[model samples]
Target: MNNAVTLKGRTEGFQIILHASASFEEVVDQLKELTVQLKKDTQKGHELIFFVDTGNRLLSADEKKQISDIIEDEHFKISSYESDVISIEDAQKRAREARPKLEVRTVRSGQILEADGDLLLIGQVHPGGTVRATGSIFVIGELKGIAHAGFEGNENAIVLANFKYNAQVRIGGNVHVIENRDENLVQSEDIQFVYVNDLHIIEVGSLHYLKTIRPEIGKHSGGLF
Candidate 1:
């Protein structure tokens, strides 16, 4: 069998890395073998979280569901399963009213950071850097990279940036594409947040306005972390 899959234990949970270039059949075969190994190694009467880390490949919704079905059985009662596309800091952070804050000097090009819950970042997101989360994402500095929030289909997720017009911003299944910049267009200095409206359109507004318009937007139930 091809070594298309591997498992590693993370501080938050277990991560299963699937080779991006492997065929779907090869991945499935590896997963079957992995399940057997995991079942035998797992201690009796204990629960754990498992995450699927598809490095550069994006799994379709159907593919994700198939993986879930494979791991469902009597021996492995997975407390939670999630895509490692977004990073979850820790379950411990969920108990607090405040979210976990990541203070980075700079997220350089080709770097990626994922979170399972609300995340506060105090730094710059350079071009090509990526930030993804299952919940809201707050950037206190310039955002010049990609920011994806509500990764697990949470429509209420928001993306906040100190400056306007970052590289790209996507929330859930919606991509906020910017086009046709007027010759006189000017960047704003206001702190802004992006959220999906009820109409499914991505909207951008001042942070204060968003909070006032949707106070509930700030409220979020921590997903499996």
Candidate 2:
């Protein structure tokens, strides 16, 4: 019997699902096309997510190389996967175990907070304020400064905010600075989160799932700024 591989795209990046009976070359070609399409869409102001299924086998050397090339070129972010194919239940358990838990309020200047779990900022993260985490960072108010997620080297971590006015942002060491903050900024009521998928750090809507499932108690009552 042949192996089957499935590729799926999400709001932040892509994943691969492997079944049985598929050619590695074909999968790589399809991924290339998907990357091109994603790039074009992003250029046009459209956001997308991606995923893949690798039934159960580890990626081939050549296939890994192709994926590495795409990631190096900044095509799209990569999320996560099992080192080996596991049962769906096992995968879910792994995901739950991998998620982080974090909390904060009133990020002041000259202060830095780092955590292995998701971070929640109830207020603004002021200029010169820095927060780093291995999971996702959520800000209920404005983000007027810098925030880094996936700090412990977990590329799957995310950073989220209600209003993005940050001078800089770093997710998994990928830095993005707002050169003209006065001109280019995102002002919206919606929550935003950044995560790494497919080797890229991408922003996406809300962290409702994380928040609901892994609620963190507030440690500091002050504002983050």
Leading candidate by lDDT: 1
Candidate 2 lDDT by residue in tens digits, 1-225: 233445565556656564445676765666566566657666654444444456556776676667657643543545554454555765654454354444547778888877655666777778898887766677777687888876766665556665445456777778766444566445555665555545474545465664543344233233321
Q: Where is model 1 poorest over a 10-residue stretch in terms of lDDT?
A: 82-91
Superposed by TM-score, candidate 1 places the C-alpha of residue 18 at a distance from the truth, in angstroms, of 37
Per-candidate Cα lDDT values, in order, are: 0.75, 0.60
Tens digits of per-residue lDDT, candidate 1, 165-188, equal 546788999998533264453556
> What are the clashing pairs of model 1?
87-114, 87-115, 87-116, 88-116
In the order shown, what is each candidate's alpha-carbon RMSD? 13.8, 15.4
Please give the RMSD of candidate 1 to the true structure: 13.8
| TM-scores for all predictions | 0.52, 0.43
